[model samples]
Target: MAKNKGSSRKGLMLVVLLLVLALGAGGANLYVLWSQSGKTQASELEDMPAAEPVPEPPHYVALEPFTVNLQSSQYDDRLLYVVITLGVADEQSKQQIEDYRPHLRSRLLMLLGEQEDEALLASGGRQALAEKVLALFDEPFAERLTAPQVKEVLFTEFVIQ
Candidate 1:
């Protein structure tokens, strides 16, 4: 009789534990559903105003590769060999770049020559240099073109020695 009672008690305990776990799982599911119910309706959001169209970026020509001098420190003696690509946005810009190629080349060469030895060592330094080159297309060269013509400056080859 005592053995039978003990078996029944163990079975009841197992049932209680199972019930508690099931209730916990059910509560968690209910909480998740309750939290998600407050979100905005997707169908209503679809009725908002349409977005404006983005203008297409102009295309330009890539120039030939060239080498430029770079300033260096005692620890690292380095010379930079850079291959540059020029973007000519319009006919005027093209003409201007052609007309002033000597001046532009001289300025670029000077700019590159003044760069720090560690400048090329940084990850984003090339991008910064590209931006600087693009800025030149906008300033004095603006009058010759309808707009600032050069869109990008690509470095095909960059070596530090």
Candidate 2:
């Protein structure tokens, strides 16, 4: 009976040891798989094409205030005082606009001077005026074959009297 008991205790110890070994092997396998997955992901990222760089914000160029006499049917004369700020596509466009400031101002004055007071005072007039201004700026300068990229025409101050 004592021998049988000793043999039974040895059998139990062997079973426990085998269980521990199996668990250790399983853990090592899992660790290897996890490490290999991380390496694969790293390699995939390296193989992918680089993303495009973020675009720059729009640049603004503010022009000096313009005051012009508005064409009026009435005996009383009318005037328009406005401040224009241009949103250019790039630095080059801004530079081009600055370089041709005098010519631009002259053209703008002529355009503004042709405006009727009643028409300018009407609703949607400001929007229409902005569109016209944008079109005017779209024209190419004498020095450059390509037009300066004028993205937007903003009216900072608009007053008609």
Candidate 3:
């Protein structure tokens, strides 16, 4: 009977110790949460750049559609037609593109006319061509005007047949 009583007391002490440890952990967690609650996110946002007045879309200039004959060395001739919209960074760049329109158009036409069907018909070829055209806009002009920053060359209509 004495041994049984001692065992029961030990079990109770063990349970009390466990409860105390759990309560300490919970209190520590609550302390952490309380500290975080005091810090408002609004205070941090003031230091960051304002995201307000959401930006408008980048301006663009629509170039005349291009139609080129791509005569394949491997197969039948395929005609390529692409409708392009060149993204200009700002009003100044737009004006630059308009000013040099004749020279720009001629350069683009020559580039397109030279592409053979075997190359243009490939899956990634059209995208590669678009990148090349974008690079062309950055080339130097006779006036030494600021290069037309062409952010993107969107092919609104692409057809190969």
Candidate 4:
């Protein structure tokens, strides 16, 4: 009877230990759920990233069409008809280009006149021409502009005859 009592006491101790562990696990789960509930929807929304602002469109200005005579070659005389446009960063840059339009146009015409027929005939030649024109526009305004104001020199109309 003493041995039977000892076995029953061991079983009761094992049961009590398991109950205590189960209760501890349940209490931990409840604690986690309660902590999550403390952050309301408004607080969660505040943690989210704000939306980005939309950017403004770029500005462009068109120059008058220019017709210039290229240096003569053995074959025939070459005449260039080019309509140029300038892409500027802002209103102030555009205004600066406009303010010095005469000087820019004169330089471009002189540059075009200096080019040989063979030199301005291919795709590479045309790209070179645009770059040169952009340089002409940028050089005069180098003091005022933080960067080159002339972003691009686009030829809206280009014809060689």
Query: Highest TM-score: which candidate?
Result: 2
- Residue-level lDDT of model 4, residues 1-161, one tens digit each, is 99999999999999999999999999999998887877666688898888778876888989999998888665577898989888888887788778777867888889988987787886699899888887775466446554337788888998888
N/CA/C clash count, model 4: 0
Candidate 3 positional error at 151, Å:
0.3
TM-score of decoy 3 = 0.63
What do the candidate models score in CA lDDT, each in turn?
0.74, 0.92, 0.84, 0.82
Comparing candidate 3 with candidate 4, which one achieves the higher TM-score?
4
Model 2 spans with C-alpha error above 4 angstroms: 1-34, 40-53
* Residues 47-147 of candidate 1: C-alpha lDDT, one tens digit per residue: 67777797556555555555665776665456888878776666667676777677678778887888876776888888888888887655573354444
The residue-level lDDT of candidate 3 at 80 comes to 82
Q: Flag regions of model 3 displaced more than 4 Å.
A: 1-53
Q: Can you write out model 2's per-residue Cα lDDT over 15-96, one digit (the tens) per residue?
A: 9999999999999999999999999999999999999999998899999999999999983789899999999999999998
Cα RMSD for candidate 1?
A: 15.6
1 against 2, candidate with superior lDDT: 2
The residue pairs found clashing in candidate 1 are: 78-161
Stretches of candidate 1 exceeding 4 Å from the true structure = 1-59, 141-148
Q: How far in Å is the alpha carbon of 121 misplaced in model 2?
A: 0.9
Error of 3 at 155 (Å): 0.4
lDDT of 3 by residue, 1-161 (tens): 99999999999999999999999999999999887766656667767888789787789899888888776776667788888898888888888888888998889888888888767777898888988898897666566566778899899998888
